[model samples]
Target chain A: MIWVNTIVQGILLGGLYALFAAGLSLVFGIMRLVNLAHGDLIVLGAYLILLLVTLLGLSPFVAVLVAAPAMFALGWALQRYMLNRVLGDDILPPLLVTFGLSIVLQNALLEGFSADSQRLPTAGLASASIELGAINVGVLPLMTLVTAVLVIVVLNQIFYRTRLGRAFRATSDDAVTASLMGIKPANIFAVATGIAMIIVTIAALYLGTRANFDPSVGPARLIYAFEAVIIGGLGSLWGTLLGGIIIGLAQTLGAAINPEWQILSGHIAFLLVLLVRPRGLFPRAVD
Target chain B: MTLINASSHRVEIATSASRLAAIAGFVIVVLLFAAPAFVSRRLLQDLFFILTMLGLAQCWNLLAGYGGLVSIGQQAFVGIGAYALFGTSILLGVNPVPAILIGGVVAALLAIPTAFFAFRLAGAYFAIGTWVIAEIVRLLVAQWKMLGGGTGTSLPNSIRREFWFTETIQDLFGVRAAASRDILAYWLALILVLSVIGGIYWLLRSRRGLALSAVRDNLQAARSVGVDALRMRWFVFISAAFGTGMIGALIYMQKARISPDAAFSVQDWTAYVIFIVVIGGIGTIEGPIIGVLVFFILQALLADFGSWYLMILGVIGIAVMLFAPRGLWGLFSDRTGIQLFPIRRRLVRPMISNDKREG
Candidate 1:
């Protein structure tokens, strides 16, 4: 029963990890930039949602509706103006540029809102849990998991079935070639970031609603997202979900065995996976 | 091959010139060692911080400059090393100094597999791959009970509880106790800074160095030229990991405590090093060193301005990329035909501009 409970909790936690990474994966899949500010952006998105919730007295779920597009626009403009300028053969420039951005965002958030962590109030939503015959699961965690699946499905559908998604993949494959074919690579990147930011907003909603968050929490979230992306593979959505689960499982199992082993165990799992298959479990062949 | 002509061309210009740089290094080291005797102790502490940043810059140079892997996740190693030192010393009953090395090795071991996992990702995948791995380690660490979980881990307040072999400095230098501690920190930082720079220089000067550059400049071409791109990259990756890990250990040793947030802060690792390298110049030997100096000075001066400093760094990086993409050191290289640490050879040619241009 303890094992079952841990697995259930792990699966739900995996959802949050998947959400955290979805934006990062999408951006990388479209444009080969690993935004160092990814985690910060998620924090920023959460902050945006927090503001919406505060101003309108709306629930966190409704607040996301208002914040997602706003965050999307912020992401779009940022990529269009800042990130696009740095994309090139030399990786140092883009990495450096993003690093600067990360510091700026972190400090900005710190200045605006002191170092004290803030939590999104969900009233009883977080505490509310339904007993499923043999076990009970928190509403927040279940929602996070469902939302993770939904985000993945929507992102996948967009990537495969939508024209913009086609453009995104094309740009990812060959930016120069995509440009020659009359698709503006920069615009595609902006749109991809916009979409990714929307996902970030969703991730942020869950991040804030489910747990305590401060300005400094972005990097930790970024790390989890990064692990999720790595475990799944570079460019696959379903793979991200699985990756999140793997990490979630590793942590929970590690915790079950010995609390200290939790973090070490996930890293060990990551290393073991690398030792066996370095390209990740489901790397996109074309990529 | 005109070996005679080339040797003669390099003869007057190379060895005698390098002597000056070597002398400068000696003088700098001497002045640095003596810094605690004259300067305010607080200033000495700041200088020590500069040294660690310098070491970080050098590691960045080795990774992005020599190895061709531009990593944004180096902080993960830095944080891990910090925590590893703390963990080993606090948890496992290891001595602090040895634990620093132990921390570094732990970071190195972790990096070996991480490099393999991340290496498969080219361009962004690799960058993101490293970042993700770091994040995973951090998240796991955050939840671990023994390591202070999310709140963080602290060490003994007094570093004096650790070993002390520097009694000679107390008698001769007149810089005692706290000042002497600063001196030790300064020297340790200097040693790390020099060692990392030296390591990178040595690596680049080796046959493997040529392969590293070949892989960086052009992977397919290097493969055709009999360079084992994969192995060369992996080796450099591990070397970078080891160096970064040491820096992390040193960082925690000085800072005296390690938290999940502080240990694995991506912002410091990803951006500051990147900024230092770019502002100083990426892909050059002295770039990170110069970059670190300039950046640290600016940081000490302007960190109080908070967001303004960040804006300046961002603008500087973007401006550097736009107008001076090569970096500060790169600009210097272009202006004067001088290189203190020559990684690439530029054979002297006759001043027959017209003939060369026509050809």
Candidate 2:
């Protein structure tokens, strides 16, 4: 029963990891550039949601709706203006530029938000619980898990079924070729990043409502998101969720045993997985 | 006769430029060697840090610039090495020197496995793979109980207690350079830098260098010419790991301590090294050295500003990537074709004009 509880909490935490990583996977799948600033963006989205909830006296869910689209625009503009310029044959440029961007974002957030932590007001919803047999789960955490599943489903639809998705796939396959086919790769990239930003907003909603966060928290979030993306095997969205669960489980279980083990266990799990399957659990065949 | 005259003038300019570059390189090396003799204690210590960064940049350059692998996780090896030295000496009861050697070996061993996984990834995937491994190691090391879990572990009692003062000798000739921990570290870093560059210089001049360069320029063509891409990549990757590991151990030796966060800091190895290599230029043996010195000086000058130094570094990194794509050393190399440490053979033929007579 205790083991079940540990696993349950682990699985629920996986939802957060999944949310953090889905946006990253989407961006990476479409554009071969990894945004080192991803975690900061997620934190920014969370802060945005927090602002909306606090200022407008809105519920967290309602605040997410408002924040998501706003983040989308930010992502679009960021890619079009800043990130797009750095994508090229030489990988160092993009990596260096993004690293600089990460520092810039972290520092800018530090300036705007201050180093003091801020959390969204969840009231009793955070304490609300759903009872299942002998086990009980926090309503907020359950909702987060559901949100992650929904985001993945919706993103998968956008990627496979939608015309926009086709354009994204075409662009991902070969940008120059896609441009020759009249599909503007840059616009597609901007849209992908925008969509990723919107996902980030969702992740932010959960993060803000669930725990205390400061500006410096983003890089750690980035590590989780990065781990999930890699563990899930890069291009596959659904696989990312499993990866998140693995990381979440490793961490929570490690924490259950010895609190310090929490962070370390996740990393150990990540390395063990790498040792076994270098391409990840569900790596893209081509990738 | 007009064409001949023009060619002759071009020859004169190229020869003079090469001559000037050789002179400059010679002077720089001499100055660098003489730094410890002239500099104050603090400045000399700072130079050690600069040398460490230079070593890292060079290792990164060899992998990314020459071998065409863009790794963002070199810090994993660095952290591993630092901790390995600190851990081996304290935890395993090894001497500091042996501990550092073990750190290098540990990095190499780690690299073999990491390469197995990372090599599966290409381009962006490869970069991400490296990053994931780095984070994995960092996290695990921080968690391991024997190593001092999350809050972090300090160096063992033996290692901490072991930093003996260098015997002071008053010599008339050259101050005999008082040997202290910092000085010792500085000398170690200097020797490592020289050896690493020497090894790289030799590597680039060998047939293997041709294969590596060929792979970097054109993979398919290199494969057609019988250059095994995977083999070259693994070799370069392992070499980078060894160099990075040695750098890590060297750093820890100076501090005489290790913290998981500091040991595994990608911020120092990946971010700073990338910044240095990018500004000074990437791909050349001497590029990273120049880059490290320039970055260190900037860092020192801007140490007064709390966060402004980071902003400046970011701005420089961004600017260099945008405008100076080939980097500072690259720009220098292109302008004059000066192979300061010639790893490649250049066919230099005197220009013969229609009117110019052969000597």
Candidate 3:
């Protein structure tokens, strides 16, 4: 019974990890960019939400709504102006540039927020939990899981059913050809990054509410997100969820056995998966 | 038909400017070696810091610049090396000096498994994969109770005071115990920087260096020419790991304290090294040398500002990446065509003989 409870909780935690990875997968699928500042950007989103909540005296959910559009614009401008210029044959420039951006964001946040860990002021949802027979699960984790599913579903619909999605696909397939076809690859990239930022804001809502976070936490989040993307196979959104679940399960199980092994177990699981499947469990056929 | 071959054939490795630079460099090194005799203890410590960082920057440049592997997880090797030094000395009672060497060897050995896993990913994935591996190593190290787990451990005082050169430095230079240790560590750092620079320069001049450049430029073309691209990359990666390990071990030995977090700090070891390389020049040997100087200057100027210092560095790094990807030294080298350490093979023939033959 205890083991079952741990597994169930792990699955729920996986949902948050999936949310963390969704934006990363979306951007990578379109632009082939592995933003080193990605984790920092998520932290940035959380801060934006925190700011909205603190200043406007808004609820956490309402603050996310306010933060999302603002984050979208920031991502769009960042992509169009800074990141877009660095994307090319050489991989080092984008990687190094984003690394610098990560440092900038981290330190700027540190200066602004004073390195003190902050949590979004939740009324009571953060502490609320539900009983399901033998297992009791936190309401926030359940909502996060549900939101993660909805996000992935909506993302898939966008990829398959929307015009902009086609442009994203077209641009990703071959930017030169897409540009000749009047797609404006740069604009498509900006839009993609903007959408990814919106997803990041959603993830932030949960992250800020669920745990205390400071500026330096970005890289650790990035590691988890990167691991999810890799395990799920690059360019596959649904795969990211499964990858996240696997990691979440590993962590909880490891913690059950020995609490100190929780984080290490996730990494060990990642390494094991990498060893077995070098291209990830479900690598995109085209890539 | 008997061909009258009168043209003298020679391949010049260095230009006249480079020769002069080499002579000047030798003089500067000699003066630096004599610095403990006259310089302030604080200044020596700073120079020691600069030299170790320079060594790290050079090794990273060799991997990312020439080998085409942009790794952000080099802290894995650094941490592992430091930990290995502490473990061997503490557990096995090995002498601290030899333990440093053992740390390097262990790091190199560890790189084999690391490269095995990291090599599976291409480009940016590979970078993150190495980072995850580093995190794993850190977490695992933190579990070892003997090493103080996550809290970390310090070198024994007996080992610190009784190390090989402590007495020799005190006897030779007549400095105090702590100052003598600093001078000894400083000398080691100096030796490390010189060897790494010299070694990388020599490697870049070899036939393998040609292949490395070829692979970096175009991997497909290199493979088409039977260059064995993967082999070249593996060689460079392993060699870099070895050199980086030695430097990491030496760094912690000087500190005499080893903590998992401090040992595996990406900000201190990897990020700053990357900044130095990108702002100096990624693919050139001279870039890190210039980059380290700029970094030292910035550190000296901005050390008082706390987080603002790092923010400024980040902003400068981004701006430099955007505006000048080749770095400050690269810009200068482009305009003046002066290579302080020239390695490009130049074919030369006696001008008169060649002209006569052509005529």
Output the number of the DockQ-best candidate. 3
The most accurate candidate by lDDT is 3
**Model 3 reaches what TM-score against the true structure?**
0.98
DockQ of each candidate, alpha-carbon based: 0.39, 0.56, 0.92
lDDT (Cα, 0-100) at B69 in candidate 2 = 96
* CA-lDDT, candidates in order: 0.80, 0.82, 0.91
Clashing pairs for predicted structure model 1, backbone only: A223-B135, A263-B140, B79-B263
lDDT of 2 at A83: 84
Model 2 regions lying over 4 Å from their true place: A53-58, A272-277, A281-285, B1-27, B91-99, B143-165, B168-179, B335-339, B342-344, B350-359
User: What is the per-residue lDDT of model 1 for residues B35-107, given as tens digits with 9 covering 90 to 100?
Assistant: 7678887887888777887788788778887778878789888988888888888787776777778877988
Candidate 1 versus the native: TM-score?
0.84
lDDT of 1 by residue, A1-287 (tens): 98999888888888888899899888877776788789999888888888878888998889899898888899999889878887877776677667667767877888787788887889889899999978999998998999999988998898889888888888888888999999999899898899889999999998999888888888667767777787788788899899888888888888899876776676677667766766678989355
lDDT of 2 by residue, B150-237 (tens): 5666665546445443333223223433345566677778888888887888898888998999999889999998999989999999
- The residue pairs found clashing in candidate 3 are none
Q: Candidate 2 residues A1-287, lDDT tens each? A: 98899999999999999999999989888887788889989888888888888789998889989988899999999899878988876666777777777877776777677889988888788889989987899999899899899999999898889999999999888888989999998899999999999999989888888999988788789878888988898799998999998999999999999875688688778778877887789989354
Better of 1 and 2 by DockQ: 2
Off by over 4 Å in 1: A256-266, B1-26, B33-37, B73-123, B128-165, B245-271, B303-323, B335-338, B349-359
Order by lDDT, highest first: 3, 2, 1
lDDT for each residue of candidate 3 in B1-359, tens digit (9 for 90 to 100):
33545566678889999999999999999999999999999999999999999999999999999999999989989999888889988888887787778877888998899999999999988899889988999899999899999999999898888777789899999889999989989998899889999999999999999999999999999999999998998899888888899899999999999899999999999999998998888899889999999999999999999989888888889988999999998899999999998888888865555665666
User: What TM-score would every model get versus the actual structure?
Assistant: 0.84, 0.88, 0.98
- Model 3, span A1-287: residue lDDT tens: 99899999999999999999999999998989999898899999999989988899999899898899999999999999999999998899999999999999999999999889999988998999999996899999999999999999999999999998899889999999999989998899999999999999999999999999999999988889989989999998988999989888999999999999999999999999999988788899355
